[model samples]
Target: MGCLENLNYEILAKNCSFKETRDIVKRMCKERYEIPPGFKIVGKGVVGIPPIHVGIREEKLVCTYTKPCHGTFVILVDSPEDIEQVRKNGKPVK
Candidate 1:
């Protein structure tokens, strides 16, 4: 999925990248609450937002399934503190 801004929570899913959202949906359809080893997918977000998929490997997310053509997967890895924490411990963002 993409990003969600100000909108009623009920209608947010209508705006996400369909393929990305669809893949995630399909995986969940096969089995509820499935996540990779040593990680967790959160069931909710701040305020009236939907569930979030955390602990995703940023490197792995930029693959052919999501892109389908030659392009870029822009990851804004801001914050030296956060980067350092991940580098040092491999801990997923909370």
Candidate 2:
């Protein structure tokens, strides 16, 4: 499997809908990385399932409007390694 670093967020934004992006990320994490069972489409691809249903700003992939996850939590991305640093922002993991 390829690394999440190779993902092209801009291309994914142009090619897929938000739901598609979310599904792809979840599936890839499960199949390729052995990380599964915990993922949701929060605002701005927020991961760890924040309680608030506050949808994030849908501005391309790396939406500036999306706020950080509640209290240092992480947003979902392509790679497990960068979940805390920089999320895939807007892109599919596959």
Q: For each candidate, what TM-score against the reference?
A: 0.21, 0.24
Q: Which stretches of candidate 2 lie over 4 Å from their true place?
A: 1-14, 31-81, 86-94
User: Candidate 1 — which pairs collide?
Assistant: none
Number of backbone-clashing residue pairs for each candidate, in the order shown: 0, 2
lDDT of 1 by residue, 6-84 (tens): 2112221333443454344444332222223333111211121123231223312211112334221222222344323
Distance from true position, residue 11, model 2, in Å? 5.6
Please give the range of 10 consecutive residues that has the lowest summed lDDT in model 2. Answer: 56-65
